[model samples]
Target: MRPLDPDDPRSVETAGRAYRVLARIGSGGMGVVYLGRSAGGRAVAIKMVHPEFAADPEFRDRFAREAGLARTVGGGFTAAVIDADPEAEIPWLVTEYLPSVSVRDAVHSSGPLAADAVWDLAAGIAEALVSIHGEGVVHRDLNPANVLLTADGPRVIDFGIARAIEASSVSRPGARAGAAGFMSPEQAAGDAVGTAGDVFSFGSTLVFAATGREPFGEGPWHVRMRRVQSEAPDLDGVEGDLRALIESCMERDPERRPTAAELAERLTGRAGASAEGAGAAGEGGMASLPPAVTAEIARRRTAAENPPVPRPRLEPPAPLAPLPSSPQPWPAGPGRYAPHSTMDPAQARRPRTPLIAAAAFVALLITIGIPGGLWFTVRDTGGGVEAAPSAGPTPTASAAPASPSPTGIRGELTFTIEGSGRVSSLTYMFNGKTTKLTKVRLPWEKTLQIPSWPPRIPWKLSYTCPPGGSSDSVAVDGNVIIRGQGSSGTNMRSEGVL
Candidate 1:
C-alpha cells in the first residue's frame, strides 16, 4: 500500500462513526475520494467535499439535500451508496469501494479500446444512465474520468455533482458544471441542462474511448467548449453502427437525441441493468477487452484485496570482506531496489553491526538526494503529471506481520500548497493519526522525516484547503506523488504503488 499524501485525512467521522482513510483515491472539481474502511472492516470510498464548494451557500444547500437522491440510483453498473451526510460542515458521501480503472486513464495507458469493447462500454454506461435517470437525477458531469471499468462492466461514479430534476436546472454561476469538451451546446450557452446533456456527454466519452483524443478536438478547454457549442465532433476514427449511435447522442438539439432508455435498448437489446442480455453481442456481464488491459485490471484487483502494509524498516547487514567482481541476481518482490541477499558465504556468517550502519548510510544518501542506492528514493514528479502505480505482487491478508518496533530514522518532510496568492490553512493525517493546522502559510513545507529504508506500515494523509486555484501534493517515501492543477482547481491527486 502507498502512504497517504500531505493534507490527506487519516480518518473521518460521519453517521456517528469513524472510517479509517486507507489511502486517498482521486480528487475532482467537486471533492476528493479516499479508500476507507468502516470500523467493521468494510471497504468503502469516502468522498469529502472540497472546502470551497462546501462553503458555497447555493451549492451546499443543494448538496446537503439532493445528494442523498443518489442513493436511489441502484443498478448492476453503479457503485452502491452506503451512507451520506450532506448536512455536515463539509458534506460527504460513502460508497462501496471497487478496484477499477477510469476510461480516461485506461485509454491514455493502453490506447483506444477495440471496437467491440467500445460498444460494450456504451451499453454499460447507457444502462447506468437508465438507472440514474429513472431516479430523476441528471448526471451533469459524465466525463470519461467518471466512468470506471470493472470486471463485470463499466460503472459510472461521482454523481455528487448531479442534481435532482426537481432541484436547480442551471449550473452554479461562473462554473462550467461539466467537462468543457463534453458539455452540450445548451450547457455551453449557460442554459438549463437536463438529462439530454448527460446523453450528449456520453457521446463525447464514447468518442474518446473509440479514439484516444478529445471529442471536440484538442486545444485549451475554452476552445473546445466553443467547438462543442458550434463545431461538429472530429469522429474520424469511429465507424459503422457505433458512429451512427454516437452521432445520434451528440445531436445539437436535446429533443433530437434518444433518451437513455432508448439508447440502452438500441445498444444492448436490453433497457436496464436487471434485464436479460444486458451485455452487447453475446458478451456476458463484461465487454470483451484486449488481453493486455484485462490482465492489468485483474492484477489491480488482486493487489487491492491483498495490499501490503508497512513493516519495521530493515537494517543493513554488518559489513565483511568485499572481493567479488561480479554478482548474481536474487529473487525478490516489487520495490525501488531488489532484495539484497547475495553475499560471499564467509561474509554472510560475520557479525552485522558494521553492515547495518553502512546500509543505513547508503539508504540515507539515496533518500536525501542521491538518485539510487540500496533503499528509498525521494521521487518528486514535479511536472504536474504523476506516473502510474508500479505493478507488483498481490500480498495477502495473512502475509508478513509488521515488526514490533520502529528502527528507522525520521527526517524533515515538507508540505506546500500553491493557492491564488492567499494563504490557506490545511489538515493532514497518516495511519489513522491526524492534526489540523490553521492559517498556515504556503511555499516550503514544515519538517517531516524518514530513517529506516522500506517502511512496513504505510501512513495515509489528507489536505483540505479553501477553494480557488491551488495545488496540493506530497511525496511519501518517494512512492506516491499527486498534484491537481488547471481546470480541476485547487484539489489534486495521483495514485502510485508503494
Candidate 2:
C-alpha cells in the first residue's frame, strides 16, 4: 500500500448514507482505498475513485457500468462487493475487508510453495475465475498480489477493478493495460484481452508461486513482454504435472490454453460438472500451504481483530493571571459590550465544508504523532490487474481478435518435444538463428507464422537431443506438407526445403 495523504477526506456520504474512514488503506493511480465502517458499523474496504477520474463524464459512466458489473460476481474465492455509489460526486464502492496476508508478500517473505500447495492455490483461483467470468467479467490482470491467503483458502480480491482504470484516457492511451511480467502476449501488445488472457496470468502466477520468479525473466516491462511474446516459460525447478498444466496455460496461442473451468477441474481432480466439485475441494485448500504462509495469515488476522491503541495526546494547560480574591458582579450596561452589525445573507447561506473539518481532524491525528491513528492500511494488487468491461466509453482492455488466422499467419511452422523426463538440454535453429534451453518442460512447442507470399520459404528443420526425441513440422493452408515424427529416445533429423 502506498503512503496516505493526511489531507484526504475522513468520511464519504452518498444516497443519504455515510461511511467514516479511519485511515487511508492505500492509494493507486486510479483510486484510494480506506478501511472504513458503514452506517451500520460493519467494517468494509471503501475504494474511492480519484477526484480527477470522478470528474470525467466518460469515466463516471464507465465506473457505474463497471461497478454494477462487479456487483454480479459471487462465490467464496472472491471478495464480495457490498455497496457502491457511482452517481455520488466522488464515486466509491465498498468491498468486504479481508484480514489476511497477500500471496505475493507471503511468497516473497517465505519462499516457493510446495507443489501440493500450488495446486490448491491454482484450483481455488481457477474456481474464482469461473465465478467471475460467469458474470461476463474478466479480471484482465490476475496476478499474485490480488490473491489473499486465509485459513479457509485463497480469496481473489479487486475483481474487475482494473476495467475502471483502463477506461479513463488517463490510463496511458495505447499502452498495454496490465502490469509487467504477468500480461498475456496479446495484452502486452495492446491488443484486446479476454478470459484467455486471465488464464495466461493465472499460469504466470503459478510460475511465481512455484519458482519465485517471473516465467519470463524480468527486467523492464517491455523486456518482460518481449519474452512473453516469443519465449517459453522458464520452468527450471517446476516439473511434472504442474509444469505441463502451467505450460498449457501460458501457450502463446491463447486458443490452445484451457478454460478457467477446465483448469479448476484439472487441478482439483474433479469431473462431471467439475466446477461444483472444484468449489467443494477449495473449502480447505489452505491446509496444503507452507507453515510460513499460514503464520502470516494468522498475524494479519490477529492484527486486524485487535487494533493497536493510540497513546493519549495531552498538552499543558495555559496558566491564568492571579484570580481576584473577590470577583466583581458589576458592569451590566450597554457600554460593557460592543454590539455587532448584521452580516451579509450570502455569507450566511454558504454551506459548511464538513469534509474540510474531517480532513483537518485526520491531519491533526497524524501530525500529533499517532501512528496509523484510526486508519488501517492494506495493500493493493499491482504487477496485476482485475475487473472487466461494461457501459459507457466501453473499456479498452480486450483480448486478441477471436480468430487468429485472419490477423495471424496462414502457414504455421510447428515444433514439439513430448514424452518428457525433463529436457536437460534442448536447442533449435529457427530463421537462421540457433538457441538452446536446459531443464526444459515437456510438450514444449514453437510456432512461426509463414506469410502467404513466402509460403514456400524455410520449410526445413533438423534437431538432435541426447535421448528424448524432438519433432518439427511445416504446414501450409492447414495441411501438413512435411512432417517428422520422432518417438521417445529416437533422434529425429528430417528436412523439407521446398
lDDT of 1: 0.63
Kindly list the per-residue Cα lDDT of model 2 for residues 441-497, writing each as its tens digit: 755666665542221233334444435554433332222223344655555543332
Candidate 1 segments exceeding 4 Å error: 160-172, 270-283, 308-498
Which 10 consecutive positions of candidate 1 have the poorest summed lDDT? Answer: 164-173
C-alpha lDDT score of every prediction, in listed order: 0.63, 0.63
TM agreement with the true structure for every prediction: 0.59, 0.59
By TM-score, the best candidate is 1
Q: Residue 332 deviation, candidate 2, in Å?
A: 35
TM-score (C-alpha) between model 1 and the true structure: 0.59
- Give candidate 2's error at residue 301 in angstroms: 2.2
Instruction: In model 2, state the lDDT of residue 382.
Output: 27
